[model samples]
Target chain A: MQERSEPEAARGPRRGRGRRPTAEVRADVLDAAGALLLERGMGGFTIEAVAERAGVSKTTIYKWWPSKGALALDGYFHAVESVLAFPDSDDVEADLTAQLRAFVRILTGTPAGRVIAELIGQAQTDPELSAALLERYSDPRRELAVRRMRRAQTEGQLRPDVDPEVLVDQLWGACYHRLLMPSLPLVEEFATSLVANLLRGVRA
Target chain B: MQERSEPEAARGPRRGRGRRPTAEVRADVLDAAGALLLERGMGGFTIEAVAERAGVSKTTIYKWWPSKGALALDGYFHAVESVLAFPDSDDVEADLTAQLRAFVRILTGTPAGRVIAELIGQAQTDPELSAALLERYSDPRRELAVRRMRRAQTEGQLRPDVDPEVLVDQLWGACYHRLLMPSLPLVEEFATSLVANLLRGVRA
Candidate 1:
C-alpha cells in the first residue's frame, strides 16, 4: 500500500484559525480523501470519514463536491497529477517514451491502478462519475498527449497525415486494455516496446 | 432492439419421447439468456427468468453455470460468435480491416457493447466473473488475432521483430478505449484509419 499523509493544515486545530485559505482547505480535504481511498477502496470510502480525517464539517465537504464519486475523481487525480505529466523535450519519441514510462510506473507500481480500475468499473453504473471521468480526467489527459503529437507533426517528427487522436488511443489504450483485461502481465519493458513498435510500424 | 427468437427445440414440449441432446439444450438456454441480456441490461437478468423463458429447470442452469456472470458471458459470446470471427485472407491488412469493421459494428450497432461494458464493470468486484471473462472471452479472442498476426509474420507481410500481441493491443485496444471512454465517438471510419495509421508508421 502507498503511504499518503494528510496535509499539515488538515491536521491542525480548526478552532484557532480565522478560517484557513480555500486552497489549503481544498488540498487538506483532497489529501485526506485520497489517503482514505488508497488505503481502503470505494467500499470503505465515505464523506463522513473524510470530514473527520480532514477536520472539516460534512457540510463544507458537500458544498464543494456534489457526491462521493465526484470527490473520489478529484482526489484520485490530485494524488496522481504530478507523476502523469507529459514532457516536451526536443525529441517526440523521447518525450513520449518518458511520459509513457511515468504512466506505466504509476499504474503498475502504485495503488492508482486498482483505484482507477474500481472507479472505471463503478462508472459503468454511475452516470455522474462517468461524465466526470470523461470531462475531468480522460479527456484532458488525451488532449495533452494529442497536443504533444500535433507538435511532433509540426516539427516533422511525426507524419502529418496520421491522426494524433488515434495515436493517443493506440498508445495509452493498449496500457488500459492490459490493466482492465489482464490476460497478459503488464511487463516492465512494455512502454519502450509499445513506443518502438508504434512509431516504426509493423510493415516489412 | 434486436429481435432474437427462442430456439425451436426449447420452445417445443419438454415431455418428448427421449431427453433432448445436451448440445441442443445448451443452445436453447444460451439463446434465451442472450436475448434476455440484450433486451434488458444486467439489472433485469435473472436465473429464474432465463429458466422460465428457455423452458428448462433452474437446476439445469445451475448445473451448467455456477454463477450468473459465467452464464451471461457464455450466452453473450454465443450470441456474437459468428460476427466476431477473424478471417485468414492472404492480405493481413484486408483481413484486419474486415474483422475490426465487424467488431466495431457489433459494439456500436448491437446491444453487445452495453452488455460487455456492464459485464466488465461488474467483473471488477466479482473474482469468478473476472477470471471467466479473461479465460473464456478476452484471452481466446486475443489468441485468435495473435495467431492470425503470426501467420502474417511468417508470410513476411508483418515485420518479424514486432510483437503480435502488442499489435493486437494497439488495434483492438484503441477500439475498446473509444467504446469504454466515449470521449470521442467510435467513428465509422475508425477501423480503416486505425489500421492505416498503425501499419504505415507515424514517423516522417
Candidate 2:
C-alpha cells in the first residue's frame, strides 16, 4: 500500500471554535476553490488565489483547508461525489446501463474530464495526494460500485463467479482510459453495448 | 481524430540534419529523459536536468529535442511504442493472453506508469500535447489490439456479435486503471482471470 500523508496546509486550523463556520460559507469556499483549480492548473494555484477567487478571507480558507492541496482535495470531493453515486434498480441490466452511461456522460461531457486528468497526473507525482485520493475519494466510489455489483450477484442477476473487486477495476479503468484518450465518442449506445458485453462473462 | 499537428521533427527526427546523430547518442538521450521524468516528475525537471543525467551536453539534448515537452514526448513514444508491440503467434488465446500479461507487467513493473500518467495529465492541460500523444502514442496500440480481436472473430474464437473496439477498450482500460492506481497489486492472477472471463464472453 502506498503511504498516506496529509497535503501541505496553508496554515494550522483555528485554535478555538465559535459556532464554527456556516455550511453555506464552506460550500462557497469549495466552489471557489474548484473554479480556481479548473482555471489554473494545480501547480500554479496558491492559497491566496483561492481566497481571492472565492472572495472569502484567507483566514476563512485556512480555517477550512490547511493547505492548498487540501483545498483542491476538498474541491475535488465536492465536485465529484454527487456525480459518482450509483443508480439502484430491480433490473440489474437497466440499473447498470443507467449508472455506467451516466458516468460516461459526466466524465466525458463536463469539465470533470480535465479535473480528473489533472488529479491523476498529480497523483503520479505526489504520493500524499495520490494516497488521499485513493483513500478518501476513489475508495468510496469503488466501494459503492462493489456493493451494487455484489447485491446484483446475490439477487441472481449476476454470475456468482464474478469478482466485485475485479469488476470495479474493469469498469472504472474503462472510464478512466476513455477520459484520458478522448478519441472515440462515448454515446449511450456505446455504453449499452459495453455493459451487455461485459455482463456476458460476469453474469452467472 | 484529434488534430495531429506534431511536427515530425518535434517527435524524433528532423530528416535533413547536417549530420545524423549516432544510434548510441539517441538512445542515451532517450534513456536520460525517461529517467528524469520518473525521478523528479515532469514539472520539477528541466532540459538541463536531462542533459546532466545523460552525461551529455546541452547542445546534444537541444540538437535532438527543441523543448522540454518535446524531449518528454519523444521519450514517452519510445517507451510505449516499444512496450505496446503485441507478440505474434498462431494460437489466438495464447497470443492475446501473453500480450495482455506482458502489457500489464510493463506498465506496472517499469517507470512507464509514471510516464503515462504524466502524459495524460499534460494532455488535459495542453491540446497540442494531448493530440500528439493520442496520435503518436495511444492510437497505434488500440489499432493493433483491435485488429487482433477482429482476427480472432474471423477464426471463430471471438463471438461474431462482439464489437472489436469495445473489447479492446475494456481490456486496455482495465489494465490501465490497475497501473495508475498504486494500491492495486498487478498480479498475474488478475490478468489471467480477467482474460479468462473476457474470453468467456467473447467466445461463441
Candidate 3:
C-alpha cells in the first residue's frame, strides 16, 4: 500500500519527485486504504494515514470519495468484487451450492469477510454509507444470483411461486447471521446443509 | 426505568443524600446507563457519563459491570426483555404469527431495535461483546422460540424433520438482513409475508 508508485524505471538518475498519473494515484490510494483498513481496522483507520502511505494529497482522495467512510467502503467493495465468483453451470443446485460454498468461505475465512463485517458495522450508523455499500456492492452480486434463480425457474427447476428475493435473503441471511454471531460457526458443511435444507423446502 | 427507589418516601422531609440503599444505587445506575445508551448510542456512550448522570462513583459502576460494552449491553438487554413477549396459543400458527409480528415490530421500530443494531454492529469487531450479546440477549429469546416450535411439532403442525435451529435462523436472518440493510423496508406487512412464505416452505 505504501505504493511503489515511485516507478523505479522513471526515477533513473535524476530522481525527480513529479506527480504520477491520475489512475495510478487512485489505485495507490485504494490500495493504501485497503491495507490500512485491514491492518488497523475501522476504529484506527483514517484518511490522513491513507494519503501519507499512498503519497497522494488528502484533497485528491477527498475529491473522489468525499469522506473517510466512503473511501474505506470503496476499498471494501474493491476487495470483495475481486474475489467473488459466480457459478454458471446448467445445474441450478450445483451452481448455487458451489458458488455459495465459495462465497461463504470468503465471508468466513478471508480478509474480505472482515472488511464486509467492518463496512456493515459502520453502515449501521451511517445511512449514506449504507446506501452506497448496498447499491455499489450488494445489489450487483444479488442481481447475478437472481438472474441464475430466474433461469432455474424458466428451466422448470425452481417452484413457480418461489420468490427469488426472499430465497436469496434466506441464504445470505444465514451467512450473515453466522458472520455476525460468533457463537454460530459458518463451515463449508453448514453451508452445504443450509442450502440443502432450504432448497428442499423451496425447490420445484 | 428510574426506579421508585422509595427511600425518598421513607426519608420524609429530611431528603438528605446520606448513603442511599444498595438497591436504590443499582437501580439508579441502570437507569442512567439506559438513558445515556438510548441518547448517546454505543459509540458515544461511556461509563463515566453514566456514573456522573447517576451520581454514582466510577468505581461503583466498574464494580457492577466489567466494561463500558458490558454495561451498555446490560442496558440494552434490560430494555429488550421488558418489551418482548412469548407466544403460546393452541393454534401454533396464530401464536407464532402474533409473536413474530411483535418481535419484528420491536426490531424494526423501537429503541430496542436500534440498540440491537448497535450491539450487532460492534459484535462484528469485538468477539467478547459478541459472545455476551448472544449469550445474554439472543439465546434466551431463541430458547423461547424453540420451545414454541417444539410444541408445534408435538401437535403435528410443523414438519417432524424441521430443524428448530434452522427454522429460527431463517426467520431471524431475514429480520436481521432487514435491520442491517436500511435500503430494505421492515414493515408489518413484510414480517407477515416473511412468516407466511417461510412457514409454507417448512410446514408439515
State the C-alpha lDDT per candidate.
0.82, 0.68, 0.71
DockQ, cand. 3:
0.31
- lDDT score, candidate 2, position A203: 26
Candidate 3: residue A82 lDDT (0-100): 52
Against the true structure, candidate 1 reaches a TM-score of 0.90
Q: What are the DockQ scores of the candidates, in order?
A: 0.77, 0.29, 0.31
Q: Candidate 1: what's its TM-score on chain B?
A: 0.88
Clashing pairs in 3: none
CA lDDT of A148 in candidate 3? 82
Clashing residue pairs, candidate 2? A9-A66, A9-A67, A10-A66, A10-A67, A159-A204
Residue A191's lDDT in candidate 1: 75
TM-score (chain A only) for the predictions, listed in order: 0.86, 0.73, 0.77
Candidate 3 residue lDDT tens string, B1-204: 434344545535323343677777787777777767666666668888887677777888888787777888777756656555655677766676677688777776656667778788878778888777787767776787788888888888777777777666676767787788654666666656556665565222
In order of TM-score, best first, we have 1, 3, 2
**Per-prediction tally of clashes:** 0, 5, 0
Predicted candidate 2 versus true structure: per-residue lDDT over B62-93, tens digit per residue: 88676677778777666556556767776666
lDDT of 1 by residue, B86-116 (tens): 8878988889999999989988887778888
